[model samples]
Target: MGLPGTIPPAQGPARPALAVVDVQPHLQQPATDRGPGRLHLSAEGASRAAGGSGGGEAVKVILLRDVPTLGRAGTLVEVKEGYARNYLLPRGLAREATAGAIRARDVMRQAEEQRRARVQREAEQLAQGLSALILEMRARAGAEGRLFGAVTAQQVADALRQRGFPVDKKQVELEHPIRVEGFHRVAVRLPTGRLVQVTVNVVGQR
Candidate 1:
C-alpha cells in the first residue's frame, strides 16, 4: 500500500539456470571403462546412458574432452538433456553418442592407439640408452670438493644434448641440485612414466 497511488510489483520464484531439460530431437549411448580415466563404449551401452523413459530424460554423449565429473575424452556418459542441448553440444566438448557415431569413430580410435604404441616404443628405446650412460661434468669447487655453485638439471640436459641425446631439463628427475662433487645417480624420466638411472660424475676444477 502506497501513500498516494503505486502499482504492486509482481512476485515469482527465480528460475534455475539449468532447471528445464529442453529435450530436442537429438538421439544419442553407454560408456566403456578403458583403464582408469578412459573408456571404449559400445552403441547399445551408450544409448543406455541416455535413459529411454525412466531416467527423467537423460541424454547420452561421447565427450570430446574431459568434463570435470562426467567423463574423459572418447568416453560416453549420460547427462541431462538440457545440458547436452544447451551447453556440451554447442561448446564442442561432447557430441551425441549415437550407434552410428560410435561405429564411425572406430577407425579413428585404432589410429590413435597405434600412435600411442609407437610413442611408447620410442620412449622405451631412449630410456635403455640413457640407463647405460655415465655423464661427467666439471664445476669450480673448494678444498673439500663442495661446489661453488650447485650443478643443475639444465646443465645435465645440455650435456646430454651435446652427446646427441634429445633430453629436456624437465625430464631430469633431480631431487635437489648437487652441491658436493661425487658420483650421483640421476633418474631420467620418460613420457611413458619410466625412470632410467644415469650416473653423473661431478669432478672439481680450479
Candidate 2:
C-alpha cells in the first residue's frame, strides 16, 4: 500500500564556517625630509616596528609634504604600486616606507616636540618680564592733551625690544593708536593664548 501523504524531502545538518582577517601597523615620518633615500635611524628596533611585510597590490610611502587630496606630511599611506613608483618616488615628495625611514621620522618628531616646548618656556619668561617692566614712549604734542601723532604697535614692540625682551609688533594688543600722553594699560599677547598686562608711560617730548 502507498503512504497517505507525499514523501518528505531529505534534510541535512547545518554547519558554520570561520572567517579570518589580518591587520598591520604603520609609523610616523618627517615633514622636513627633502631627500629621497630611506633614512636609517639609531633608535633601537624602532625601524622594525615601522616595517611592512605585505605583498603586491599596493606600495607604502611616507609623505614629505602635504599633498592635495591626499594627506599631510609625517603620515604613512598606501597607494597604487604604479602611482608610488612613477610619481611620488620620482618627485622626492615621499620615500619608501622602509623600517629605517620610519624610525628616523619618529626621532625627528621627538626632537621637534622638545624644541617647541623650549620655545614655549622662553616665551613665558619673556611675558613675565614684560609685565613687570614699563614701556616709555616719547611723542611730540601741542598744548592740548591730544598728541600730534599716534603711537603704533611697532613703537610698542620696539620699546619692549630695547628693554631686552623679544616681542613681536603683533603681540601688543593695542586696539587703537594712543592719541594722548599719559599712562596707558596694554595687553601683551603670548603664544598659547597667554596675555600679560603691561603699563605704558607715554610722555610728551618737550
Per-candidate Cα lDDT values, in order, are: 0.78, 0.74
For residues 1-206, write the lDDT of model 1, one tens digit per residue. 75668778788999768777755333232245344333233345334434444335777888888755566688878877865676567768788998988876676798999999998989988887888888999999999999999999999999999988888999998989999999999988888888889999999997
| Model 2 per-residue lDDT tens digits across residues 72-139 | 78788876665567556676768899999999989989998999999899978887788787788899
Q: Which pairs, if any, clash in model 1?
A: 29-46, 29-47, 30-45, 30-46, 34-38, 34-39
**Lowest summed-lDDT stretch of 10 residues in model 1?**
24-33
The per-prediction CA RMSD against the true structure, in angstroms, equals 12.6, 10.7
Model 2 steric clash pairs: none
Per-model TM-score, in order, reads: 0.59, 0.59
Task: Tell me the deviation in Å of residue 104 in model 1.
Answer: 5.5
